[model samples]
Target: MTPLRQRHLTTAILLTLSCTIAIAKTPVATGTGGAVATISEEASRAALTILNRGGNAVDAAVAAAATLGVTDPFSCGVGGGGFMVLYLAKDKRVITIDHRETAPMSFQPAVFLDNGKEMDFETVVASGMSVGVPGTVRGWHEALQRYGTMSFRDVLAPAIGVADKGFTVSENFTHLVDQNTAKFSRFPATAALYLRNGKAIRAGTLLRNPDLARTYQTLARGGVKAFYQGPLARAIVDAVNRPATAPGMTVRGGAMTLADLANYEARIRQPVHSTYRGYDLYGMPLPSSGGVAVFEALNILEGWDLKSLPRDRAEHLYLEASRLAFADRNAYLADPEYVDAPIAGLLSKGYAAQRRALVDETRAASGPVAAGDPYPFQQDASVPLRPAAVKLQQEGAHTTHLTVSDKDGNIVSYTFTIESWGGSGIVVPGHGFLLNNEMTDFDFTGPQPNVPEAGKRPRSSMAPTIALKDGKPAFSIGSPGGATIITTVLQTIVNYVDLGMRMDQAVDAPRLSERNGTATDIEPGFATGAQAGTLARYGQRWSDAPEEIGAANALVFNPDGTVTAVSEGHRHGIGSALVQKSAH
Candidate 1:
């Protein structure tokens, strides 16, 4: 059988198993007036445990996040980085916290460039210097201090127990290890933990990280400072500076200095704000183009009454909005600390009007069109990337997002990543986790746009988002795909409000993304093949393969009094559960 056909067979088997398992598990309580948390089952149970102990959503969120740090260590942990968007029901306030990692003050932009030329992907993607000052712990600690009702130590208990007693490695963890074995072999400490007897640990095997538990203990006793300035930091410095750590590339680890770790801090910033179709949308600020791009795409598509339009017209709207927003993303968006990112201008009606003018009623634009003025159009002129015209296929894997809402109406949506797999695979001994290779998130060489800069935040695709309808929190959504983060979140909201899909249907629905110039949908063999075919009738280039659609986890609250939640069926390791307000 052809490779595509073989994948279809594998997909069919997985889908059948998912359905069977979903049915076998008892349906959790769901609906109005109760709390709901959507995340991995292990994490969900931990949150529910907190709720049962009288913890609010903030408390439950802290619990779930800590549990994820232990069980899903490959994708996210205290060693990595993340961001959060929160909605408070009591006063009806929306707030965002930016805990994105920062480039160390000692970090040099030209460090990734060798002799004035951009380094190859291998050099840029893997190195100790590629590590950013981690911010996930500090970010979460600050959020809890300001908003949480439960003691921070109490929230961390579940994670400590899981780590100390050990937990089974999930299928997802196994896949990540397989994909990055080369990097794991380069770092002795990383290999010792993730690889057993010199081989990747098999799925379902119980894995323990005594070192990570020790790190968590330090934070629990001394706050986030312990990781940055205490023994943990010293141990990290020692491991990174060791002569054996760097691969035989042009660069080495002498760059990660002690002062860099001692001075690291995660910044807190205001969220990007906009109103779309009478609903308020709030998301991560600069360093994350998700907020502006999603808002722009939604605003552009708002002019069209998609509910009454045919499939083709709806698809046309999706493509046009993507093209405009993406052009803006590439040319202008960056760390506001480093660039004068025109957040206000990009989301302005004036900018939308200018972009709207470029959308033709029929036929795709012959080539990419740049968003004018603040974002001048640039013709891509490098070696022909096969899926030319559109943005490069952002590697699509290894991210996880969780959204939690409690009876008190406090809601939190958080997104996390270790970049790709075991990250750069250069673990600091005694730290027990991989550092993010987020340096690759920036352009290494350019006309100076999106290039790496010391202390500048790298652009991110994670878009943990929330919407307010009638002045009340209505939905929380996000996804796990390298660059498809914004598109997935935008599509989920559109599916819920525009298409009137329930949470499950919305998440399982087909998706399409366009940026720069190309448009892509879930491969034809995807469960939503019909949706892709229907979209193709408009303008998108639908691939017959099966890897293009993103995996989503989402939740929606209805005015009619129901809380609906869903996890993507195709996500081999994902599961969603809800504990509604009115559940018996």
Candidate 2:
């Protein structure tokens, strides 16, 4: 047999083994009432508690987000920022809140470079220079004030309780701690809190953060002002500006000030809207590229009969469409306030048709694919198309996502991040939260759309999406994978709507990512077999990677007034709850 045939035979054996192993897993749950899905069990339960207390989805989301700060601190907290895509069933509206972190007033494009060369990853990540003015607290406050029925104090109570009483550390948390012990040890506050005897505390150890509890209490009592304008804000600024004094660690501090925090406001923007198979999809708009990328990819794929194609061929088409979308993402998407992003043209079905024609079903586009001129389809046709910039460095996979829905039909999909695990490795002395390294999301060495600028929010790939069917909420889904977030979410939706899988199966299915890059990365099960050769024939380089795509959580609203929530099992501590409330 030929080498390709031999590889196929090996993959067949692997697929058989995978099928055997898959049979042992527990079945996904389905129920009625309301649903909460998050990366942590504690957070999920906290949201469910709020939902049970007659709170709307926004209230439950805030509660769950705050709880995640306590239980999954490494991924997100007050020190981070994120976007919330909210659906108010009563009003039948989709509101997207942009709480993405902004560059400090002192920021410049060259901040992450030394003598014109990009600084090493460690120098940038572990330094305060990577810190941005955190916007998550403000976002939580804004979300609650506008659409929630619960008070800030009520929503924060569970998180405060979690912080004060402590929770057992999971194996994943322990691994992260162990992995970054050196960086954590560089800062006194981080070292004191997370490390014991020069090593990470063992898994299952009940750890309490009294300082974070106090911070939560302060915010609960005083509201957003306490975090942005009070002593807590001062403490945050002080911690970020404090230099690392350890040997061989030459990373400098940041210039975040009280003004940066106080000036921060989470603005409400219209969600990016699109249609896929008669279902309306709404995603968080720029500085998040997720919604546009998904919209564009779906539009491109709409030309094909995806369900009728072979599974391998469908995967090939999906990868190509993703690449095309990511090309636009890298070239055009950015903070809308900073760039004249061609949003209209980018999402237009006409433009998508134009780009879709570039794809050859028999083979992938050879050579480096550049972004198309989408401005032609816009009303303002004078908008110029810039050459595609080199793809930015991949973001660390330390983000967290949650989806919540209440009995009243309110839904919220939120994706938050501190940029990386133990962001900046510098916890505030009294605040007990790590500062975000979100500044690193900006391009340092190029005239890219996401170049750092004073007070500008960095571009993001945090896609929180909700799909509506016949003007009724159908699904709310999102993931935490940095650059891979867009592809992961797109795949999940395709799996559910096109392939006809359950939400749980959609989230659990193998995923692939092609971020306008040369190679397409595929997860275990789907990477093997004749598909590899099929993809290779299309000039697509296949990378069989594992667990690097995303950990997506999704909730599907069934026709019988029931809901099913699924938390992908790849990440530890994932939890989903369905609470059935009686009809009034």
Candidate 3:
């Protein structure tokens, strides 16, 4: 071996040894029946229960997701929308579902702007105008009808039970409620649902939402029609249009009509596919840029010997790759129905090669790099490439993710959101669920592909992903963290596959994210003296704050038919396995 190759081999060996020794051993929940991982323990348990009861992965996913809506209401609910990535083991095929929220047909691009100026930040967040026509309920119904073996009523039972019987408020729930007291107080129904005696309910307080339970029950009994066309739909519209009168403001409400709700539909789109180190990666496609971005970053990193590099250098490379990927993400990714995103070009190995050539190993790219031209690599030149435009919109970290797998080999990775905590702070009067401020996901200020438009789904960062090894399902993973979701998933895959970390260690490892920015945000433990200095040489400004990067959950399907599931403990996530007990 050459001197350089030998040196790299030695360094890799040493680094691996150090990392193995440094990482604290964490237990991996394993079982033969199935596995469930999620942000809430109750949700994980609900999924496991479904798996043990002969439910398929799809059924368990729906049950777990529904439970999360009840247990983690501040993050996601029936009033929101999300995406799901599923692997049908029987068919050996992958499916992606896009239930992302859409702008009302009456909505205009300037809705969030006043007289050509941006509206007050508070108004944009708390007002009815921020609400989008919700699609979560419809999405759930579609998943059950198409892929699930169980009925909608059966899948929703756990969520309904939780909502009706009530659950103890978790510390996270209490903290979020306390933080949003001002906004929640603006809406009487919201305050009544979450607060008591003008104070945020403390942790351990038994909180129940009978109205939400009734809504879920109505859907269970009447199906999707109950939510999209019946009383619940009307209640949503009226509540969104109801004017708010605060002490110093009278914010006008939304223009969501019954037609908007009636016309809402969840679509089954093609999953974005790529290969990294012989592993086939599948992610949700647009209106989510996550899959494309992750693929792009992976494609770029494929050219490097990450294992040969020192840990800090490896991290620097990751940051640079993410920056390049996000630059393209900001410019091109959007709702494919409304915008001509260059899917073929973006995922092409040739295009990735071109983008990879632009990376500087010794220094970071100065300033924000403009999106590259990916159209030249497209096979079909019939559709002209739209000019790229930069879109800057604030996104929150409030969201939930769940992953489930069954002994049948089926797998599900799902991520859902309401845009922000207590989304729009508008509870549909008597419904007890928060409406999504998903409209804020659009770029109102920029003339971009993701600009708000009638009948257009907002661009999203919800990426539910699955990876396969040697033509068998290996991992089902996803996370909840707005734009950071892509980077989080990418890092976990890198940690597990490239760095040779165990499944639990991969999910628990410290993470860093750089979303086309000069500053690289690192979790506290990962940013320190020598490593920080090495990254600084690459022109990376460090932000050591514990940025809520993402709460990722993953399930590793072993070749022997057993499954290992892991949840990021730092985020208070939980994992459970449906182990079959040998006859006692």
lDDT of each: 0.69, 0.82, 0.81
Find the candidate with the highest lDDT and give its number.
2
Q: Where is model 2 more than 4 Å wrong at Cα?
A: 1-28, 244-250, 383-385, 524-534, 544-546, 581-584
Tens digit of per-residue lDDT, candidate 1, span 1-584? 35564444334422332232232222223666445444466666667666766667777777788777777766677666778888878878878778777776666667678899867776545676667777787777777777776554566656666677787787777876877777676777888888876577899999998887777767766776777886887776665555244256233563566677766666667777888778888888878888888888887787778788775676677777777787777777778878766666678766677677778756666456665553322222333212112234244256678877877777888887767655566776876776777767777755444677777777887888888888887777877677778788887778777877777777766676665544354544643556655655555564445564455666677676666655665454546565644444
Better of 1 and 3 by lDDT: 3
Model 2 residue 86 lDDT score: 92
lDDT of 2 by residue, 86-174 (tens): 99888899999999999989988888888889888777889889999999999998898888876666777777777887888988789
* Clashes per candidate (backbone, < 3 Å): 5, 0, 0
Q: Pull out the clashing pairs in model 1.
A: 33-581, 34-580, 34-581, 389-518, 390-518
- 1-584 in candidate 3: lDDT tens per residue? 45565445334422332232222213257767777788776677667666665678998899888888888888899889999999999999999889999999987777778889988766787988888899998898888889888766667777777788888887778888999998888888888888887679899999998998888878867889999997888899998888444356465688999999999989998899999999999999999988999999999889998988887777778888898889889988889998888888888889988998998887887767778888888887486756664644677777888888887888999999998888898888888889888988888776778878898898998888999999899898788888889899989888888888887888877777788865677776656667677788888886646555688888887777777887876654333333332112
TM-score of each candidate structure, all chains considered together: 0.87, 0.92, 0.92
Evaluate residue 313 in candidate 3 and report its C-alpha lDDT on the 0 to 100 scale.
Answer: 76
Worst 10 residues of 2 by lDDT: 18-27
Off by over 4 Å in 3: 1-27, 243-249, 382-391, 524-530, 573-584
